[model samples]
Structures are given as C-alpha cells and as structure tokens.
Target: MKAILAAVLGLALALPAAAGVTIDAFKTDSGLTVWHVEETSIPFVALELRFKGGASLDAEGKRGAVNLMTALIEEGAGSLDARAFAKARDGLAASFSYSVSDDTLSVSARFLSENRAEALALLRESLTAPRFDQDAVDRVRAQVVSGIRSDEKDPNAMARQAFDLRVYGAHPYGSDKSGTLDSVTALTREDILAAFRSTVARDRLYISVVGDISRQELGPVLDTLLADLPETGAPLPPVAAPAFDGQTVVIPFETPQSVAMFGQPGIPFDHPDYFAAYLLNVVLGGGGFESRLMQEVREKRGLTYGVYSYLVGKDGADVWLGSVQSANNRIHEAMEVIKAEWARMQTEGVTEKELKDAKLYLTGAYPLRFDGNGPIADILVGMQIEDMGTDYIATRNDRVNAVTLEQINRVARDYLKPEQLSFTVVGQPKGL
Candidate 1:
C-alpha cells in the first residue's frame, strides 16, 4: 500500500509535464513550409501566411510603401470591391486580418471548417489581384499622414524615433516602419503595385494552417490560392549592421512629462548569443514588474509609473533600448538611476538568486505560449521566417534553462555598456 501511494503521487506531478502541445511540421510541393496542430474540441480552423519581404524592403524614398500596400490589398481584388470583400467575409462569419512588421507581412484568417473555401478564396484574391484603387489609396494615405502628424505631438513617439535614428543611422531598420508624411504622400499607386509584385512572390512565402485541418486537406487549398503567384525567388538584400554613433539628442517639447530613450546596437535573431541575450533582457527589463529596471527605477525610487527595456531584433540589425516617462523635473534623476542600473549589471553582474528566478520564470512560463492552435501556428510561421529549426519548440525551454550565470554575466558586460549608449529625451529636461 505504501509503494502504490508513492507511485500515484509521482504520476500526478508528471501529468502536467506530459500535457504539452505537439506541432506537426511539413512543407508544400512549391517549397512553402507548413506547421499544423489539430484541436477537436472546436470545429474552427486558422490559416496564416507570412512573406519574407516586409517594411525592410521598402525603397530609399518609399518608406511606408509596404504598409500602404498591405492596407490596400483588401480594398479591391478578384471581382470584389472593398465593401464587397468585407461583406463576403462577414457573410461567412469569418475573421480576416493583415499586418506588416520590419521582417514579415502576415495575413491570417479564422473561420469554421464549413466556410474555409470561401474565406480562402477571398484571401487568394487579396494576395494576388489587389486593384490599388485611387479611393482606397487616398483614404489610407490620409490616415497614415494624420498619424505621422499625431506622432509629432507625442513625446514618447518622438523619443523612440529619435533613438532609432541615432542607433541605426541610414539602415532601413533605423527608419520608421511607417513612412514620413512627405514620403507617404509621394507614394503613387504604381509604387504600391510594383512593391507588391516584387515582395509578395510565392517562392518567398511560408504558410501554416492549424485546427481541424490535415496536410492532405490543406495541400490542394494552398495550391489553388497561391497558384497564380509568380515563383520569382527574388532574394532579400543582405542587411549590414549600422554603425552606432553614441550621442545624446534632446528634442525640446513643452509637455509636463519627459520621455527618456536610451539605446545601443544589439544582436540579430540569428546570432549564436540570441538566446543568451533574450534571457539577459528578461532579467534586466523584459520581465516587467519582476525586472530589475522596474524594481530600481519605479518601485524603489518612484521615478516613473513604469520603466522597461527590450531588444528589437530586426532582419539586418537589432537595437537594445530602455525607456521611461516621468515628471519633467524628475527626468534627469530617472536617467541617473537607469544609467546606474545598467552600469551595475555590466560591472557587478546578477546574483545567483536573480539568475535562478529569471530562469524559473522564463522556463516555467514557456507552456503558456502554446495554449491554443492560433498561437502555436503563429509561432511556427515566425520560426520558419527566422530560419529557426522545427525542433525549436521542443528545445526552447531547455535552451533557456541552460543559460548559466557566467554566460549572463559575459553577455551583460559585452552588450550593456551605459557609457557607449545613445540617449534621447523628448520633453523639457531640467538642464536642457
């Protein structure tokens, strides 16, 4: 009886560990990667398509062209106007959305299996046959231009933009993903069409479908939707790291609060130290309320409501940034505290307790990312785009768990030099 009770207790703890999700991976005939996860609890399905060339592919003067093209895709395509295209999805009770980032453009749709055919047809039209009508272009351009003007008045936006420029210089990632007002206005319909043809090629595409779908069922659907796209394997240009000219830029604004942004060049996604840097960032600032930055800058001194830092990993370059907003009078003091924390992380390194807790939170919380098919499919697509291996899901926690205190200390010293960093303040500072 004693032996049986012990066996049962051991099995109970092992159950949660064994209950993790499994994502099956495969590829299409045309070389597009596919990741699938099936859930029988509901009759819903989601398909996501990601293209390699995103905002980073924009031409020198055409900063916002990729974003504009993404917005215009659904405006008119394949025997449907913008309203008709929307009504088609609404009539089927399906959800469709498109988004652009520095590295990729994603189009996703979620709907019942019964409506997958019609929903996918609409997606195909949006991808291959966008009309780029004048009305839609003008409307979205106005909105974007208005947004640029709005950012001019926003101190936080100003600070972030200034920081990127200071760190990245002439690199594409250094520029705002959204083009400036002048560049956006200069973009013609021809430019949008040309960008689409060049960037959205089938060869540069990866598709992931999850929830109540199999490879056999999805293969023909994908073929039909993407059949018309050209197979031009236009390779992306190599993105070189931009030189960081360490300087402090102060943008004078009259707001009661000041937004402080400090930055330096960091690691790209494919770097060997990527995981180590990611772990270090969480301990430093990415852990939110549990992070040292928040503990020292906010909780300890009450300098601001929140202070945090992150690495913006891009296709060519990455940026390490720390930002906060506080009273105008407290801006300089807040900077001092942030600088102190950065310098300390570089010199003294993290405690065993700090490193242990960071690993615990990072590793233990990994399962939350795969709670459903939608998020799992999203991660799979992103992994494929970043050239991460399929086993990345299975091995991710182990990688985080393997980061040693020595590794953290080395990365902290190498990447977190406060004196070599650039500073941007977008409100009235006490001294300036």
Candidate 2:
C-alpha cells in the first residue's frame, strides 16, 4: 500500500502522459457523474475519487483539520473500530488509500471484482459515517505532529518551506497542509467534523473507475457509495498570485550539505504555449541527467550530485521550480551553474535535436502509464479533474508532437526569466 500509493502521489497530474485507453462518461441518477473504462481482462476493479478543495478548505485558524480528517476516515467507520475496520478490509483483501494535497482529497480503492459489493459497502461506511472516535483522532493527530516535528530538522523540507513562504505568502498554499503543532494540538473533534462536512460532499466530487465494471453496473454503485454526501462543499480558495523575485534567501542550518530550492512564475495547464513550455523544461532539467541543468551542474562541473527543474501547476497557481544539494562550500557554484543554464535556455531555447529527443522520451513514456487497471483509473480521474476531454488519452501524443521548435523557443523566451528566479537555501554556507 505504501509503495503503490507513493507512486500514484507523484502522478496526480500524470494523465497527460498515459498509455492508450478508452473512457466512458456518465451521470448517475443521484446526480453523481463518473468516468469509467470497461476493461474485462482482469477480475479486479480500481476506483479513484477526487474531491476538490483539500486542506485549503481547512477553516481559518483550523489549518490541519482536513488533513487529519482524511487520515481518520480509514481508521474507523459506522459500528467498526480501527481493529474491526482493518480486519474487515483485509478480510476481503481490498485496498483503500486516502491522501490530501493542497488542492484535493484523493481516495483510491482496489478490490477483486467478486468482492466489489462488500468492499464498496465498507468504503461507503468509511466515507459517510467515519466514527472519528476520540482515540482514533488522537492517534492520527500524534502521527501528523510527529511528522511535522521531523520536517523541522530536515534540510530539504526547510528549503521547501522557505520557498513556499516566499512564493505564496499568507495564502493557504504557503503553509504546510499538515499545520503547525499549536494548531493541530488545538484542533477538536468538532473541527474534524466540520472539515469532513465541508469537503466530502457531492458538488466537490470527481470519480473514475476501471476494470471489470460495466457502466450500468457502476451507476448504482456510485449512488450507493456517494449519494449520502452533502450536495455541496465549501467554496474554494481564491486564486494565488505567486511572487517570484530575483533574490537569494539563505537560512543557516547545521547540516553538511546545503539544499536549495529555486523558482519563477510559469504558465498554466491550459495555456496555448503550455506544451511547448513542457518540452522546453524537459531540455532544461526535467529530462534527468540528459537535461542541461544536470549536464552543466553535475556531470561537467561536479558541483552537485543532482539538479533538476519541473513545472508545477496547482489549482490556484503555476510556477517553474527546481532543487539541488551540494557541500556548503560548493552550493554557490551549483547555483551559479543553474542560473547560467536558466539564462541560456531563455535566450537560446531548445534546439531541434533537443526538442526531438524530448518528444521521443515523453511520448514513449506516456503509454506505460496504462500498464494496469489501477493506473488507468488514476489517469482518467486526473484527466477529469483537469477538465481534459475524454479524447485526451487517445490524442495526447499528437499534442506533444505538435509542439514545434519555434513554439518551444518562443515559450522559453517569454516564460523562463533567469533574472526573476528566487533562491531559498538552507544550511550554513561559506559564501553567497
């Protein structure tokens, strides 16, 4: 569960790059819409449900409510305590994973086709009638607090915290979804209930199912599992305007290796030049060691072990971000090389060969995402959340292939401003 769930966590936006598959879209009698794929090859089913406004829906001053609530949902349900719930779920050999990010709460379920009814019934209980007993709440809260405390002493986490603070300021996106110790310690059972009622409602739900499930068969199941939720949820947070200034901030930490996070504003998923920018990023840093950032900073200069950049498109904002770590004495050199690569990409953009290579890897890698039912289900759900049409899976590579060299260069020049890159470094260093 941990391994597979962690893999999917990295792929929330992975539909743009999935293997070929078909999607069936329908709305249940209860006004619940679901996108499904009829794959009868395997006698198993994978269902993914994404509810909008995740931890961001936490009430003001009750920052970690949604996160803690999500954790507790699988702890106990209806008449079952934690032990009973786990026993029931494992008895059926079913799997359920609940996770929350800044934008959404995701529920992923996998179970044998024969056990579908029982598994979904148990899941329904968890969703609509989570016990949230004081004991369960205390246990999960303690785990969350422990993780938060551990992050305080982590250099990479410290850099990320500093970077988010500078970019998002007072916006919900700026803070950890898990909340501070004081806030989590102050949370009450009522706060957890409020977060649940505000988020696990029908109006915020998006679902996708795959494997041995027919559209007709799935419609009723959808209502059974979801119809009881509230018809609406709390309003989403306002759009964030990320602030990416061209300055370096260094936080002194007692670590041998310094970690640095850098970023600038970026385009959204729907922007016309988005595909072009995506390809350009592959050339810049996202292509692993083949990327210019890796080549210039690691392979050539030996300044850092690795340096990579990626485009992050969240519900409220989009930004170009990157990270690197090096000996305190060499982190400055790594930063200099990264900035130089950034400027070079902006001015020269990607060459024809670089663009061609990026297209090959991105197109080739997308199909692997359809290796099984679970991946297909997750991809389809992400596509729905991003509002991509059903045809996206079939014609995705076409879109990637259509990004011409001219388009890539134009997007690079317009979007990648080296002068605007902000650096947040954690750990003691000899020089700036």
Candidate 3:
C-alpha cells in the first residue's frame, strides 16, 4: 500500500512538469469533432459528449421538457430497464452521468480499457435509444417537482430566480433550468420523447476523450457511438436579449438574513478583451479573500462573511454576477459598499501591485487543473466549445501574462457599470 501511495504521489508531482501535452483533434466522416489526449499512465478512459441547444430548444409551454428528457436518458434504453441498466453498468465497473445546463446536454463516462467496448456500447444506447418509459418518466418528474417545491422556499434559489427573471425578462435564460412546478407537472412521456429526438444530433455535438486511447482506435468508436443520432438538432432560439433595467427588485422572504444577487451584461468569452476583463474581475470580486469586494465588504467593514462576482458567458448571453448574504438590517448597507466599490473600480481600475498579484495567482494556478485525465478531458472540451483554438492549452498562461495595466483599466471602464447594475434581494430587509 505504501508503495502504491508513493507511486500515485510521484505521478502527481511529475504530471505538472509535462507542459508539452498536445491534443490530437480530428473530424469524423459524419462531421463530429473529437479531441484526444493520450495519457497512458492508467488503463482507463474518460469521455464526454456535449450536445448544444440543451434547454434552449424547449418549445413554448413545454419549458422543462429538454431538462426532463436529459435526466431520463440513462433511466433505461433499448432492451434494458432502469434496474437492468444500473446492473449492467455495475457489472462492467463503469460510470455514466447525464445532465443539462442552459446551453448543453452532457453525457460523461469513465471505464477501464479492458471494458472499453462494453462501456461504449452502453453509452451509445443511452444517447441513441433512451426509452423514456412512462413509469420512469413519472418517477423523475415527481423528483423534479419535489426539487422545484423545495427551491420555492430556498432564499438563495429565490434570489437567483428573481435576478434572472429581471435580467433576462421573457428570454429562456430568465427561467430556471428546472422548470416551474406547473410546467414540469404538465410534461408527458411524449414530450420527453420529442425532446430526446430533437436534442441528440450530430450537427452540434462536441467530443473529448482522455486516457489510454489511441487516435486510430477512437475513430470507429466515435462513429459507432453517434451513428444513431440525427444529422441535425432542432434549431436553438435566437440569442436572448438580456434586459437589465438596473432596478433593485426585492422579494419578501421571511428570513433574518437577506441574500443579494447583482450583475449586468458582461463581455463574451470571444471578445478580444475577455482575458483583460477576467483579470479585472479577479481583482473586483472573482478572487476570494484577496479581492476588492471581499476587502471592502467583509474584511474592513465586517458586513458579511463572503461576497464574490464572476463572468457568465453563456452561448445565448453574457453577464457579470455576484452574491452576498447579511443580516436583514445590514443587507442594504452591504449593497451600498458593493456599489461604491463598483464605481471605484471603473474610475481607478486596479493598481499595479494588484495587477501583479492577480496575474501571478492566475498564471500559477492554471497548471494545477491539468493534473488528472478526467479534468483534462473536461477542460479540452470546454476550450473547443468556447472556440478557443487547439493550441490554447499551450498559450493560455501567456495570454494571462500579457494583460497590461493599461489593457485592464480600459476593459474595466468599458465593462463595469455601477449605475446599470441591478440588485435582487431576497428577504424582508429594512431600509431598502
């Protein structure tokens, strides 16, 4: 056991030094793009399938259909029932996870090299031939409804829902990924089937594989896994026009502490100044204790225990959002401090010292993310989805390092809007 532990630690230490890891990328005859990183240290593989137009493809009045369909894909498929499918996966010692966010429905699996063929076959069934059985659909729908009912009383959930509704208005992004109780309860087995057929297709698929797999071997596997999916998915809705009027909307939840979620339109990931704005955001709120918001709101004034902000560049819209929680009486004070800091950042930008520290932390911490095969596969697929080039892994740190104080200040002024920032406070707070 000691020897095995030492070998694992040794491998972990050695992995960070392998900076020359190259991704082998190719397009299949069916037009699916697959990225591979051959890590031969373990006899295993981590695979991901990202289908675009996730929840955004839901038809009107059937808001949660796509989400429900995604959750049910692995419930059963073809000849296998839910119990049988679970048993088969356990027998092979493989894992499969199915989920959907606003923009993508992702299926991920990991398996030993010896069972690669079996694992891949199981995954193909889940994606291509999901049963969406009536019993299973009812069961999962009940689960979803339960979750929605719980979220109704959750202050944090209430704040997020209120914030998105205000910011995105009638757009699909305004709604929670899990549909409302009424919408979800209305979903039927046929709705799930239509959603599955419309969502899983080749035109918008993204693939990434890591571990003991060779390019020559992965080609046929890719073809087989995706062979049954349609050529194109239902077209996604147009890009959402996120409407933020900068009003401070308050939801009256009975809690001693109030939670505030705030943000406005943010720069897209593809924007030229994205990295600069990203670094600026780190100084503003993305960085934890070292960030300006943490310093002003918690460290100096003692208003709250934590506060943070981050960039949200979804496929349909981009945003900069943050959250904080404080006593109902002091929540308004917290908002004041946040607004002051927001304005101060646009005016003064980050100091040279702040910029240096942010760059050092950002650049140094990046390589740690590539330590394992599964994480590496995720990052590779994410880079491609964001349209970051194949060579991004090698050049990412360089880009972070290249952001000058001038660039950051320019982006700060352009992106930060104190007056246009909207706040959604959940809880009955005095002095709002």
The global C-alpha lDDT for each of the candidates, from Candidate 1 onward, is 0.79, 0.90, 0.87
lDDT of 1 by residue, 236-283 (tens): 757756555556678999999999888777888777677788888888
Winner by lDDT: 2
lDDT of 1 at 317: 68
Model 3 lDDT tens row, 1-432: 234434443453356432846899997776678999888876778898898888988888998999999889989988999989989887877778988988999988877778889989998888888888899999999999999999999999999998888888878888998888999999888888888878888888899998888988888889988898899889887898887677798999999999999998899987889999999999999888999999999999999999999999899999999999999999999999999999999998999999999999898888888876667788888888998988998888889999999999999888898888899999998899
Q: What TM-score fits each model?
A: 0.91, 0.95, 0.96
The residue pairs in collision within model 3 are: none
lDDT of 3 at 265: 82
Q: Rank the candidates by TM-score, best first.
A: 3, 2, 1
Give the residue spans of candidate 3 off by over 4 A: 1-20
- Give per-residue lDDT, candidate 3, residue 8: 42
Lowest summed-lDDT stretch of 10 residues in model 3? 1-10
